[model samples]
Target chain A: MKKRSALIIIFTLIVGLSGLSSKTFAETAKNNYRLYCSQCHGLTGNGEGIDKPTMGVAPKIHNNAEEMIKLKDADIYTVTAQGGASVTKSALMPPWEGVMSEAEIKDMVKYLRELCNCTEK
Target chain B: MKMTKLTCLILFSLALTLPVRIAAAGDGKTIIEKNNCGTCHKMEGPAAKTFAEALSRKAPDLFYAGSKFQEEFLVEFSQKPYQIRPAGTLYLNHVKTVDGVDRIQDPPLCASRLSKEDAVLASKYLMTLKDPDMKIGVYKPGASFFKIGAKMIFTKSVACIGCHQVKKRGKIVGGTSGSSLYNAGSRLNGDWLSSYIRNPHYWDPMSPMPKWDLGEHAWMQLTNYIMEMKE
Candidate 1:
């Protein structure tokens, strides 16, 4: 009876820990996107927003998965942090590396892949 | 007998001259360049005479303005400027390199900074850009093709109708990204229109319209269609 109870408790702990970790990751991803990616890239990633009018270059719609697939995690992250010019895209996209934390950038890269349904290696 | 002959002659001459007096008179080409139209727009081809290629701009070219805009409409739009056509503004920054990237060191300058006289003169010059090369095409005016064409422009192609006002069942609808197309036919030229649609960035460096890969028929058709927009 004691061994069975102990085993049950251990299994519950593992399940609880896994659930919590996933929840934390999700929350972190949401925060990263809202803070860094939404300005020019847009909340829905449609490339249309208040920023779209004034932007010298229109940001790509992240909803297009095929286009997103061509880009890499490092490329997206560098673009997010370094601005569009760094990636040789548009100066309108400002770099966010100094503005955001390293972990936050990584979180954003993952967030982009998720939002666009892009595969990341 | 002499007085009766003189009166008859005067009456005939006055009748013939009335139509000419009623018509609008102005030299559009002289008006454009004198007013510094080149600052925002590039009507000429690549700068060959100059030592360096002028920084590429974003405003659409006016090289074909004479061929595009009708005279009365040009005078009217010049006097009362409004964002009528809804084509996307041509302000996308040209990427100097293959990656299509550059650093924006400063914000763009607004015309508000200019004096009132300068603004009026600039507006006057912009009114004169009619493309001389635009000969009327074989397409019938007010044909079903134009409606079908405008529909395609709004839907399948650049999706310009999302931001611009195109005639829809006689009602105008769309966002104001650039000017409205309700008056584009009355205000633009065919050759300039074709060149602009082919490459919007060639004229204006700061425009947001993407360089779409369109074919010759579509380009000519769209240009011809837009030139007929008179109010």
Candidate 2:
């Protein structure tokens, strides 16, 4: 009975720690989105950004459910890190690999999913 | 007794002239303070840590203005201020989208043009504030690099035009997210420009500008080409 209680405590602790870590990651990804992407990608992920006026190619609307739902999560990550040009898109969207870490980029992709409210494959 | 008298006389004379010397230096500073220039421009260091704070900044930080800008350019610009950043410093503040078209809604201009006398004094005072860590004399003008190479690097690979405005075909074209580089040669110090282009993160970690690794030679070529853009 005592061993079972200890096991329960360990499991609870593990769950609690993971929840906290994920929350932290969400916060970090939100901050990064505002800092870097918000200029070309609107703060609300509506594609109407400050740089939209000057850019030849408009920034993609992350909140467009239909459009965003079509993009695979991995493709989103590549676009964020490698820029649009790397994927044969517009060159205006700059690569963020130098500015952000790999982990941060992954978190950003997850945040995009959250923004788009896209869970369906 | 003679020696003491001589020393006293010298000290008294020196004391009489010291205030005049001090007043000369203080004139410019006094004008700046009286004008309340610090209200808009940041006179201190430690660039914004968060994007929120960066967006809140009303004007560019003037703490390192000495290293960043030229005295003549500052004086001229102060006297005749014009819109440089089309969307403003923090474009997120001024830019608005209507009917799927992004428009700069009544973009707030910089602090009104200073009077000729005030411009001279304020520019002089601004020149006193310098970043000690920033090195000078690194970028040499007239490096004899092909202009086309720099143009290609700026527009294509590095894509500086995505943010900054540059003169192309005698017309200003490029993005408005960053300060216009049409006459960057006249406005900025060559060494400071080179240092900034190489590693902007060193100055502002939260800078919107991306860090590109285009090698040393390419960076210099780009720098030299920019340096030649004298208005």
Candidate 3:
């Protein structure tokens, strides 16, 4: 009876956790990039996103080391969390504060630096 | 023993006739099941709880079909279905790196080609699946509202135009990330639209749609404007 119960519990655990993944959330900055940022920012963060053609104001290319290097780390964090419109940019870039945690946003700022391969000058 | 045998024969005959009665009556559900619509669309919920589960979903939930869509639209759409969301359902799944440039691919359009009679019957069954939580009659068709103001809010204030496609002076313009709202007035129920705008996560917990902190008037104005779009 004990062996059968243990097997049942193990099966239930596998089935219950099948589609559920923390990887889908903002657990890692790379996962977060795929989840929310990839649609508009492009998978490479090159601003060649699928939505670029229709957007009134193009999404800024995050991978451009020169352009990205001009902005401070705090500025990047602000735009990522508070949105572009808050800093006199496009309203098309909606805020992600509701969707991501502070730590996650901070991590994304770091990720953007990594994507650009440059730090703020 | 003879009487018992007779009763069994009678029962068997009744069972054989039950399907005939159901066919004559509205067996629209049977038609839907026969076509296996559940293979794609979710017919029941407790919706997907996690983002991963939501992403894995192949089609929209049909459990609350009655509350979301108009009967006429549903009936017609089932017969001649087109892709409404330009980026496909869960755009993440369809994004492809084509020629080193990321491009969006089209999701398969429905090819069911249901007969008019079957479409009507199936819609009748779908229209019966209402969500009690959704409050109806929030938007009145003939109510006084300003389109210019509503348009301004949609395109500028909340920037819904960033994702949803809308008509612009006979031109099909605006982003295609979200479902096109060009025919929203005729396609969607007003109450459901209002509720969804306030909180899309209410219906789809893992939806990436941003809920703006706009005033009540702005929200209603946006709803009124969207509900004005047709055909």
Winning candidate number (lDDT): 3
Task: List each candidate's DockQ score.
Answer: 0.01, 0.28, 0.33
Q: Write the per-residue lDDT of candidate 1 for residues B200-222, one digit (tens) a residue.
A: 54444223344455576676667
Tell me the number of clashing residue pairs for each predicted model.
44, 0, 0
- Tell me how far the alpha carbon of residue B166 in candidate 2 is from the true structure, in angstroms, after superposition: 2.2
Off by over 4 Å in 3: A1-27, B1-26
lDDT per residue (tens digit) for residues A1-121 in model 1 = 9999999999999978876531133336554453334434555665554335544457777767888998888888788776665666655454555445578678878777788887754
**lDDT string, candidate 3, A1-121, tens digits:** 9999999999999977964743234357876787678767888998877777788788888899989999999999998888887899888888878767788899999999999999999
Give the CAPRI rating of model 1: incorrect
Docking quality category of candidate 3 according to DockQ thresholds: acceptable
Could you estimate the TM-score for every candidate?
0.42, 0.80, 0.82
Error of 2 at A31 (Å): 4.5
Model 1 stretches with alpha carbons more than 4 Å out: A1-119, B1-64, B84-146, B169-171, B190-195, B199-207, B213-230
In candidate 3, position B119 carries an lDDT of 90
Better of 1 and 2 by DockQ: 2
- The CA lDDT at A62 in model 1 is 75
lDDT (Cα) of model 3: 0.83
In angstroms, the error of model 1 at A38 is 11
Per-candidate Cα lDDT values, in order, are 0.52, 0.79, 0.83
Number of the candidate with higher DockQ, 2 or 3: 3
lDDT of 1 at A37: 46
